[model samples]
Target chain A: MTHELATLEKQVADLRAKLEGIERRVPSNKLSMVVFSGDLDRALAAFIIATGAVAMGMDVVMFFTFWATPILRDPAKKVEDKDFMGKMFGTMLPKGACSVKLSKMNMGGLGTAMMKNLMKQKNVASLDQMIALAGELGVQIYVCELSMELMGFKREEMIQYPAMDFCGVAKFLEEAMDSRIQLFI
Target chain B: MSEAIHADKVMDLKGLPCPMPVVKVSKGIKEVAVGQILEAQTTDPGSLTDFPAWARTSGNEIVETIQENGIIRIFIRRKV
Candidate 1:
């Protein structure tokens, strides 16, 4: 009977600790976004939402993984000593934010060029501008280390961003768990 | 038919497309004080709803949105 009582007390204590953890995890005025696309239009949308969230006084965190990781690579800064597969991947992927194509109707880059022309005429911010603005706005840019390892992307080739970091998914998940809004772009 | 709004700051976002209007307004809202009014003039049709929605989510109050000659003039009071 005493053993059963002790077990019950331990279970109650565990439940109480869980409850306290949940209470401490109350969502803040933050937006956690997973940027899974490297397309020009989608990247624009991600950064657009990110910068907009920042303007609203909410903290924004963008986890760039998979196809999205290449968007952060700087065209001017090239990393040497890559493996054969890494070189092939780097050659195939878009160099930077400006080189990415549209998701649909790219038409051998004509559509993308036309769309960029339209945005320019309309005075809309381009993807590069949005990314730069995000940096200026203090939006956290987190690159997925796993994706980096798979694609052989180096940290030295990343764009000049103030609050950028190369981290694992757990770091992003922790922030996402406490964010008021979570988006997978 | 209505009186002019004496805004604390005015942003000319004319010819900017959808999403940019609100994003511009969001960035530009920093110029106004907590209670002052911010006026944004844009030609984009999306601003009709975007301004009010952005103001709602951003904890700001939308004063009025006036449309004249394809130009949308929105007034929002900064609260955040």
Candidate 2:
């Protein structure tokens, strides 16, 4: 009986140590971002933060919604079965991650091109490169399902890079609750 | 001005901007074995602070930082 009791106590102590380890790592080591802008500069900011946090050993989740959804769209992928409004949106908005414009002084997209050139000259990684790095570093990219439905975007329309996940605000909120850093961009 | 420490790997991040140097360093450190050193050369002024902060947060050690002719060389020791 004493042997069994000692074994049980040892197991309890081990479990407590494991729990302490988890508590130390969780909540403080996670970063969550709500990426709500499709503008080139804003997307760059989001990716910079994500990559920075990942470099700091934080688990990052970037939830793309609304206007930001286009950042994940594949430039060459076409969306079929769209209603008139959807077709109009598809025609009007810039085609995907590659074609996103700047939020200010875009100058008919020339400003964005200039900014890309500047970034290149300065040796800063482009948005596409940052996204690839995030993927390599295990940063999770999530698409808002509601935003996709409202914007008439199909699952197949998104680029396959980084392996995205689809979820709703509720799910994002759940993640944010446990994350130490949360940003709405 | 001091003698340079031997590094297991050298990563060139010259001309890269804020965050890329650190990002690349973070990735490069993974390629080095524990206790080995990685030497990263960059022109990003931000890395002066970014490298130390990253090293602190990532549990690595920055053994040396050398600045010469607008170039920064940081030697990092992988701790884990």
Candidate 3:
């Protein structure tokens, strides 16, 4: 009987410790999101999430790697430098429609053009504005060091935002693991 | 601004979205000295409900909430 009692006591202690650890690490406020994709929609979504998190009294961090880094490129352009076609269309079309073609991947070139026109009518926030607001609201923007080198982007060429930081996948993974929410946009 | 002006502090959350207005306002109000007033302006329609609910949960008093030009102007006097 004593043995059983001791085991139960140990289990209880273990559970208590686990609960305390969770309470200590989990955010006191709302969700934490890690967005993975760098499409315009993803960019906008990340901004909304980060800004929303901050507005809701939660800490927010965004690790921009891969294609997402272009959104953070200094002399920030409406479209990425890598996609020459996107830039051509971005310059030709009004801002909102610039991302429409990318969204309708199956629609062929014309479909994308139509989508852009439709999106503009919907009053969605422009890609550039979303990036700006994310910076303004103090969203932590981290550039993947490896992705930066591979993309041939110099740190000096990246957009200068107070919340911007640089790190690797491992560090981002560590931070994302502790968050209440993780998003791959 | 009405003459009541019962409290001295102010919090402006105008043009911010849900959770953000609440977040900023919550932080802003916490810093005010007890018994001081906090006035916040929020463009988000949802703050009409969210702010008061948060205020209740956080133990702050919502002295008044008025709507003008589609914006919610809330007056909170820190009770706790």
Candidate 4:
């Protein structure tokens, strides 16, 4: 009985040492978190960052608050009703690079028609595809609780994603503090 | 000797940009059969790092690499 007990103890110790070796080999730079304030410019940046991060083998979390939530809202309702072309290509060409102000640059009643033309001409991705790609690659996208309440948005209004969650600033900050790059956008 | 690919075959990826070569190579190699050689020539400097890593990740064989003058050429063979 004593010899059998010693053999089992040795086996357990070997297993623990092997597990420790595996633990040490695991890489640490695998996590990232970003916060996007409600802005079109920032939303675009966040989308690009999230896509790039996933491709580079890092886990990414993006918290959308205030103005940014609208960018993730129903693509059918939001993008179709506005001047999306000017928002994408901007106005004034070379000099007017920053002219397409999302908050101010409405093409009046002709906004929706311009968006249709732009979508057809530019071959831009729809919001649904962007969200789908983000979700497919394990990007966590959280909608801010305060922003949701302020905007009166329900869960159904947001694009469906497995990583989608509604959380407050406190939780967001806790997650963001550990990330390599935490952007307000 | 210049390794020859069949007349019906060519890896034509002109006007492709960085990080795109990896995607294109990924999609391109799928069309070639196992053990067939693929000659990948790209202008994107990122391919220097990207394609090798991709070859490693996908378990394909990178047979040869050369930098002639300013252009980069890589020869890869499908493993499985």
Top candidate by DockQ? 2
The worst-scoring run of ten residues by lDDT in candidate 2 chain A lies at: A89-98
* lDDT of each candidate versus the true structure: 0.89, 0.88, 0.66, 0.60
Query: What is the per-residue lDDT of model 4 for residues A70-125, given as tens digits with 9 covering 90 to 100?
Result: 55555332222225443442112111111222333445525534653564454433
Pick the lDDT winner. Answer: 1
lDDT of 3 at B39: 87
List all candidate RMSDs to the true structure: 5.0, 3.5, 6.9, 8.8
* Residue-level lDDT tens digits of model 1 in B1-80: 35587899989989877566776788888888899999898998877877777878889998888988878888889898
How well does each candidate reproduce the native contacts, as fnat?
0.57, 0.80, 0.17, 0.00
Evaluate candidate 3 and give its CAPRI docking class based on DockQ: incorrect
lDDT of 3 at A149: 67
Q: Per-residue alpha-carbon lDDT of model 2 for A1-185, expressed as tens digits?
A: 99999999999999999999888667857999999988988998999999899889899999999999978878878767899877887777767777888899889878888988988887778888878888888889899999888878889988876658999999899899889999999
**Model 4 over residues B1-80: C-alpha lDDT tens digits?**
35543322347554445434554566677678888878777666666787788787677977777666555677778776
Interface RMSD of 3: 4.6
Model 3, A1-185: lDDT tens digits are 99999999999999999999988886544444555555655666677667656655566788776666666664443333545554453344322213323543535566655555665665445665666666776677777887666655656656657777788888777777677777776
**How does each model score on TM-score?**
0.86, 0.88, 0.61, 0.52
Which regions of candidate 2 are displaced past 4 Å?
A1-28
Q: Global lDDT for candidate 3?
A: 0.66
Docking quality category of candidate 4 according to DockQ thresholds:
incorrect
Q: Write one digit per residue (lDDT tens) for candidate 1, span A72-125.
A: 999999899899989998999999999999999899999999999988987888
